[model samples]
Target: MADQDFDVVVVGSGAGALLGAIRAQEQGLKTLLVEKADLFGGTSALSGGGIWIPANYDQARAGVRDDLRTAFGYMLRCVRGMASEDRVLAYVETANTMAEYLRSIGVPYRCMPKYADYYPHIEGSMPGGRTMDPVDFNAARLGVDALETMRACPPGSKLFGRISINAFQAHSMLSREFKSRFQLIGMMLGYFLDYPWRRKTQRDRRLTGGQALIAGLLTAARKAGVQMWRNAPLRELVQDASGRVTGVVVEKDGRQLQIRARKGVLLGAGGFERNQAMREQYLTQPSRAEWTATPVGGNTGDAHRAGQAVGAQLHLMDWSWGAPTMDVPKEPAFRAIFVERSLPGCMVVNSRGERFLNESGPYPEFQQAMLADHARGNGSVPAWIVFDAGFRAQNPMGPLMPGSAVPDSKLRKSWLGKVYWKGETLDELAAQIGVDAAGLKDSARRMTEYARTGKDLDFDRGGNVFDRYYGDPRLKNPNLGPIEKGPFYAMQLWPGEIGTKGGLLTDRDARVLDTHGQVIPGLYCVGNNSASVMGPAYAGAGSTLGPAMTFAFRAVSDMLGRPLPLQHADWLEQPERAAQRPAERMAQAA
Candidate 1:
């Protein structure tokens, strides 16, 4: 090997890049993983850590009969032309193989049996088991590598198996009088404990979905002897006159260094979430400030820019994996509001104080609604998620903001716990929040009435498998509870995201294709850096990570020209068994 050369050079230590590097190493290739941040994990460590893999190995073994045609059909119908046919088909067909390969390599995974695609009501949607999440791993097991990378489900985000907010409310609504009171007290105690714990822990460490995935992958990568260079941003793709990518010009420690790639170069540096100009032009929103939770410094668009210079075909430049966030005033980061989408019996209202869309619907749908609001003269301003006192008592708001966190001093003055409210009565609350009091009162009356009848006449919210899966089965009304109580609370929500989903186009084999649709020899892209397989819509929990890992596995397989064998197939087949194994031994010595 030369002074700075490897068989593969992977830009960005995201899940996709990590998987690609691992695969390349397994193929007897010397792989180098470079990241722009001091930490190894990229935006992936800041995500929900779910991977959407229809008819995956775990699902198949559980006797779920999802096929390639069905999965592809579902993707097409759900994405509705937002995703290319070839890309969708490639993801569906290779999803299972990727899942199997990762399991064999010792990445602990569990099928989220109750989760579904974002739009299950659409034709070809699966009922359950399409998404997968990483099995919980001990951070201590990561050793020195743990300190070097970010962990998903960071210490700040974990709740001790707490259900979604709506689920808790439904449970509260259905319990007997004595049971309800006891449960309320218990819930309050749990909340208090978690609140203090989260605050104290956050000051020291953050735990979240991204943290979990990165920790697991980093552990595996370290054990496999893969060298990861942090704060080394790939400046340009170095290619020979033959049009073959041979190396990269990276700026590390303020010096430009040429790192050669002998086998291939994989671009998985993530999307352009923090690129204000791109966000402004492509997203059409004035404020790009609420775009993400990952470190804002990594949004230089290095991967996209580098790929474009080499004629890599770009796809879905105008798309994103959408999320709702709360602009935490003075804080440097936005607060992600999971309850607004995951919690039932809540409604989102724009500045005009009218219901926009189904609050618990797919995130993309919510984003589209928000974008429409911006188009109608509301550019990412304050949006309110209004729910009743019933909701306040029953549902758990994960974190509370101090007066210091709020941007507006007046808004901060009204904070009580994690909720913001200004009402002695329902009408008063409505007026305080600047909504039409009469209209809000009327809407609440109708929704509460429907809860008694166990039906949502307006949005058909709880009628589907997807909605019901996230709904609390304890309540007869499921998603139809009324917000009629006095002292209604509103939590400000913003348009945020896990990561951007548009970048270099690729074939099913994960090879980077050019603008003319020709393969960019010795180049590949996977994960969030590549256009999503599901297209504009997000599926269930693990959709993002699943495809990222799958494509990475496929990219390596194509490079190596063969399937890698597992050390222990039987143990790998069992979720508990696989998750319990030591991280150091997860990946076998190549």
Candidate 2:
């Protein structure tokens, strides 16, 4: 074929692909970025948009001290034994470098100082400052010409800055009189106004998290002169006589075009969470057919299949990051488990009507527990988040719908299933939910006894610091409150996910390698298209986006044959001291 040009061709337009394109452009390599979807961003645009980077420079500046050794230890414990030590080490070490690179490219970032890993009690876990989230950007800033090309989070949703499940629970714990009603009103108003601002600004020019991140890198890529193509899908990877990849066939505008790559082809097309076949086969949950949290229309595991076609090895394909979701009526899209504001004393029960877990735990744990219950023959098909009237009046369970702006209505008419069920006694509610009424009544009675004494003897639900983080401090019983009230509530929940975690297996350099541990020449993967750096487990806040962007940056540096500078060491040495120094204070004041 004719030399169809460009030094590197990046597949997919998520964080990884965009980062790779930016890096290639920075290296002055002619680059091309192709997206199968009409819009860019992929799932990254639809996510909470946090990046978990432990021991990052921003933490040091924010009076948090975390070293590589500590971060590495924490990561290993977080992933259990699934992730290779070298891979974890490489990711943790390069986190700051990646964060700095993005900042240099004008992607604004903020440190989440109070966020903890999903398992805080795990050895080596940092209390805070392990995650970083992007500052909410004004979509209008990217300019009108770029607006139509960008995508935003689903309509009617707003992501609060550095907000944690615990923080939200704390807010929900306030008594009605002590509540910041006006602040809540203001928050709702801000969301409405901000939505229009993003839309109106984009009318002239579009800018958003996914757009801004991509646009910033696109600008850098353009300056470095990288060629990018939208609406082009890679049909297949072409190989040389030696069985090495040399080019790709792309289908665009009803025509087939063959483009040769002299260096490499990176597949960051994201995972197959939205693909019904893959979801049914791997997840084995009927709810997989309805999940809407993925990149609305296009993520179908194209990269996984394409790479597999060339003998690329795969890892963690049977596992996912895991999510607790609720099924909605209008669409199959699943919403993340909105831990009912009333969960302090509530318990999650499977269809068998047995309490499976503490409802206040992290989402990953909740998902895993539910899956296990399903395995034990509890029927994962219809699990329920059971709570009481007292719980409902306190907590906010997130927006009524996945992408909606409205708060969930207190009445059952607005919710799915029988959100409200009443019985004069605990036995009635248990029978209503189809669990072993005796088991449930016994469980509730025991729990009530423990609550009267301010303890959860059975599950130790609120005994831990992590659990207390979500508990109502003012309540006499933080966790074991009785469910003796007349009316109880149970909302149906299903397995939901931010995105799938399993994909192409790559090394520290983000190069897709085969089973023999040989790099697939001209093949690379990043973001959700590759196995997560965190493995099967997820950490707090920005876990998904953090590693995605970090790997993307590393992939770019690897493509450029350059080392990311560890400049933060100068600032990291005695991070606390440096942060507290008088000169730094003066600098901030100035």
Candidate 3:
């Protein structure tokens, strides 16, 4: 017997879970969203909040040219058959519609015209305008209590870990554009002027990045009257004799409760990145929980374990949304180095002091390069970003910030020996960081020469539009500048990820599939809980969240028995391996 009932029970409180709950509730279903931790918003709240939707309504309104066919072609090339063609097609075709739906529901997604695709050289890749970010939202709208309890954005995502700035502002400021100075001033003034909220919390009420995205979704969920439960850790799936998922057992208030779900259960609880044991069993070697930048409390594979117990097949468990993270002293979590690596006058090198990859490339590829080099016994697991005083003056390095804004004099004395290593000469820097001195000197000289010649002879650092997107525009090659200035520095970088990618495999409609590739009726998975739609490859900036929210929308639509979109209906209807109906499969087994 069930203790309580609802049309849907949503596990996890990230962007996808909240959006799914909202959609289900708005469609007249009694939806309940549950989170294991007391704090709402999983890794999604800690993310950059960029949503990549090709040919989105916002882009069209802004007169940016794009189409489904072009996006499909580009993604197909990027993933190289690692992902399902149907799934890829579903995302490309339905993404624009999903974006339109979000806007209708009050998610203010504004297109970022300069945010180029990670692989712009690929056929059908657009120069920019495929990615959109949620505009800054006032936290006061969600009320003081909600704002106080929400998971805060990471320090790397904010200005000095306090002030909020939009994605566009971050780009301009990081690139050190002339207009960015005034923009910063205006932002500081706006934040300080909010005197009433300032007294209550140091956190900026003007939310940006993942904070804003989750705030918007959380607001929608509340408005739709979705029942939200905190500290309710899902224990197991409840199924009837026929094997149809009907409810879930969750620990609430230190007691297990069986809640009946009339429609289905959504497992949106995030990946296993934070679980050290899971990391050892499934992921590539040399990975660690300490390396990940996800929130500290949860996302330890609760959904994956529960789904696997019921015969749900898992795929791509070894892959992740990899990024190089910097270890800041005394910080609870690592800070991912995203914008800093692309700036001029710096290079990432292995212990042998050899340049291994194009430092200015996309973050995932950057970490992949590290792991690949480490696999070859080059000791690239803890690589170092070698930079001179010139680079320090122009850019921020992890938590160090810019030298001009925060000089070495302002840095903590404790940080000098641990957070970073400083040297008056290249050889001295190499010695302090335990790298080959000769190799360091040679690499620095080569980079200096490349900056003067406007050509990266080795890795072609600024070869593409994507690489140059975050680079310094004042230089001949935005990604190349002389590293000859005295007083060099080195900071450690680990192959860290925002979240792991592997989990329960699902179909185009976001229905969980069993071992035999049949749908497990009344079960759906979204976000990091399911196998990523993009497969092993990352498409663009918002690749993770875009598919997450899109499929969440699709899951609710399928739950309501809504018809598939007409344009892609033909391909979608033709499943390569025909999935049997759940009841039919159960009867066959009997």
Models ranked on lDDT: 3, 1, 2
Clashes of 2: 12
State candidate 3's TM-score: 0.96
- Runs in model 1 lying further than 4 Å from the true structure: 1-3, 60-63, 82-84, 151-156, 160-209, 329-332, 377-381, 398-419, 561-590
Model 1's TM-score against the true structure = 0.82
lDDT of 3: 0.87
The TM-score-based order of candidates, best leading, equals 3, 2, 1
lDDT of 3 by residue, 184-223 (tens): 9999999889899999888898998899988888888888
Which has the higher lDDT value, candidate number 2 or candidate number 3?
A: 3
Model 2 global lDDT (CA atoms, 0 to 1): 0.65
What is the C-alpha local distance difference test score of each model? 0.67, 0.65, 0.87
Candidate 1, residue 313: the lDDT equals 75
Candidate whose TM-score is highest: 3
- Compared with the true structure, what per-residue lDDT tens digits does model 2 show for residues 181-247? 5656655465555665555542212233444555565555555566767889878888787767777
Residue 66 error for model 3, in Å? 0.2
